[model samples]
Target: MALGGNPIFNGKNFRGATQAPPVPQAYGQNQYGQNSYGQGGYGQTPVMDAPGWAAQQNMTQDQLQQMYNRPAAGPAETGRMTYDDVIVRTAACLGAVMAGAAVTLFVSMPLASMLMIVGALGGFVLALVNTFKKQPSPALILAYAGLEGLFLGGLTRILDGMFPGVGLQAVIGTLSVFAVTLLLFRSGKVRATPKAMRFFMIAMIGYAVFALVNMVMVWTGAVQSPFGLSTSIQIFGIPLGVFIGILAIGLAAFSLIMDFTSIEAGVRAGAPERFSWTAAFGLTVTLVWLYVEIIRLLSILRGEE
Candidate 1:
């Protein structure tokens, strides 16, 4: 599949995902005898008398030299997305998430539980909105991050209580996985090839089905174990969650690779600077998925121990 196969990148529409960056047009003549700058036509001499052109004609040697010495416009100045833009926006989103999480972390259990529910539902709705919206919205993206933080914080509190220190361990594990995946991508050791994407889609579908069924069973009180089938079902004395958790973490790691690939393509395609928020939002979504998977896996392992 192409780098833009992900729904999160549907707005970009990069042509071939390898098109060269657009070159700025010169002010000189063109095939039609028109000033390529759009100021005048071949039959018009008004462009020569234009104040801006006249000023250029009268420039001092030193002034011309200074103009030549000036640095070229960067991606931001050209109104195109850049890696720096994506980095800054992603940081902002993560900061909002941390702030939201802190709010739930210090609150009473009852209030935190309420906020967790609110956050889960709110985040889900906002995520869908952001994913399908043609244009990226910074405010909504940050709001989604904050809501996810609340859900994560509440979940961590509950899990940490049951498995002391598991929260910190999970955080470390998530960061480690992210760092390793990034390094692999940067080294060109991994990619989202068509074959890999096909496998990823299949696995994702199966995982989603399992998750949905597990959720329903939990709600209907169909399983006595805390994690429903994950704990109740075992293979050779190992809980089913262990295998499922590993698969989930692997999928989340691959998702980070997809995010990286898409963001790189977006930058290369010279997408609108505003789309940096979209890149940031995509990364935040993947990172959240990764963290949740890591934390859940840790909880399951702790439960087993």
Candidate 2:
């Protein structure tokens, strides 16, 4: 149901129409790897530049000429994705979420719930703010993470109380999905292609509409069950909420794939380091959606039992 909120890229980093540059070749190289042709005893290579310079110097006359005539290094090669950068930023995001969750769970459930409502509201506002801002702000992104933590913590508590152990199950499930998706992405088993993206958009729209209608029914008391029509309907002897929950979880997983694709593209294109926050935010959003879906599904199953 587009559960985590609109993607932050929409207005902040990428407008309706903006594309990053092609992937760079020198993205993962050492900072000083570039070849510098300075006169130093003609054949005497400095220790720092020895390897690269020797390789160039050893080239055939025709090859040397071609190499010297090549264009300057592109942005991709000059400044690209680094494993360290992604790791540090991701850790920071997770830390914020955990810290926020801790406060919600240990201190006071009501306060935590209030914080979650605030976080949800604040996150929505910041998502729009960061999306539209010309430049990304680390502070805002981190703040979004914190707010989301509150929401997730409060949500986990509420669901956990009704369906004991669901919180831990959801946590494990979310991590497993993330790990598997990442492995597949790195191995090239899955990708975000034009066709898939198109389908995702259409499906997301339908899901959003359905959720909105369900919420209205729930709030208006048109359906007495906790989950409205979802809890009331059954298919193949299982609650419809369970079925919808599965679909929602699948959507969240696919959303992770999309997030990974975007991050890969950005890194290849030499996107500014600040974009790491955007990537973090996207992952957080997807994980939250995954957890929520799992919790709700568990609750539905428990209710049925």
Candidate 3:
């Protein structure tokens, strides 16, 4: 699955899905006691009946025309993944996330904070499980989305309290980024080429290392700043977080491109319809990452102001 970058569609889970399954054939004996057309029994030639041919000729012109006008079978009919399937499943996942976030909104601050921790930890574990699972599970994927939503909702509540309306701004920013990236991908202006994939992987490794180090510093109380090294360090007169946030946002946006490519490949390869859940899960993960980066960037800017 040289689809580029997304581990979810890296080509393993879709084994034996390179082509659509063979359509079923009707079985019957011809007048000569040979297999009927498409029966192909015992290496014998299939026979078409004269009556069947005559019946086809006897059909009215309008009936024949109507039959000819019928649309061809699509991915759904073939039981393969389709863009529509991906869209529907992705919407369901996002909806579940919203529902989870709503729970945080109605709860008290303490409970919400506790849920944020649970969501963060639970989401991470589910993410890894779903990523490596050979089969996609709708329940697990939806659970992961909901947990992520709780974490986002709690974080947003805290940040919005500090900087009014930043949460809304971040939402808008995230959507804007998603729209622009999708447009670029649709327009064929951007693709996850092999060279680009290599670069992405390298950058991802560097970013992951930095994030882990930052988290460790924060946990150990080595950095009193809210964002650990991001706030404590400065480039020129500006906080380093501003730069880091921008970089993270860029990475997240590119990750969306990767997801789109993988989904397209999966559809083209005739992957099972159930695998659409995997596509949805991948998109949700990237979107969550993008949202967090945008919100964090907005918060850093607000704090600086």
Q: After superposition, how far is residue 67 of candidate 3 from its true place, in Å?
A: 5.6
Q: Write the per-residue lDDT of candidate 2 for residues 42-149, one digit (tens) a residue.
A: 577655565466665666888756645656655434444445566677788879988888878786767877888897888778766766677667898788778878
Best model number under lDDT: 3
Clashes of 2: 5
Candidate 3 C-alpha lDDT tens digits along 43-92: 76634554455555676888666655555556676678999999999999
Q: Which stretches in model 3 have alpha-carbon errors above 4 Å?
A: 1-4, 11-13, 18-70
Error of 2 at 195 (Å): 1.3
186 Cα displacement, candidate 3 (Å): 0.7
Worst lDDT 10-window in candidate 3: 25-34
TM-scores of all candidate predictions against the true structure: 0.88, 0.76, 0.87
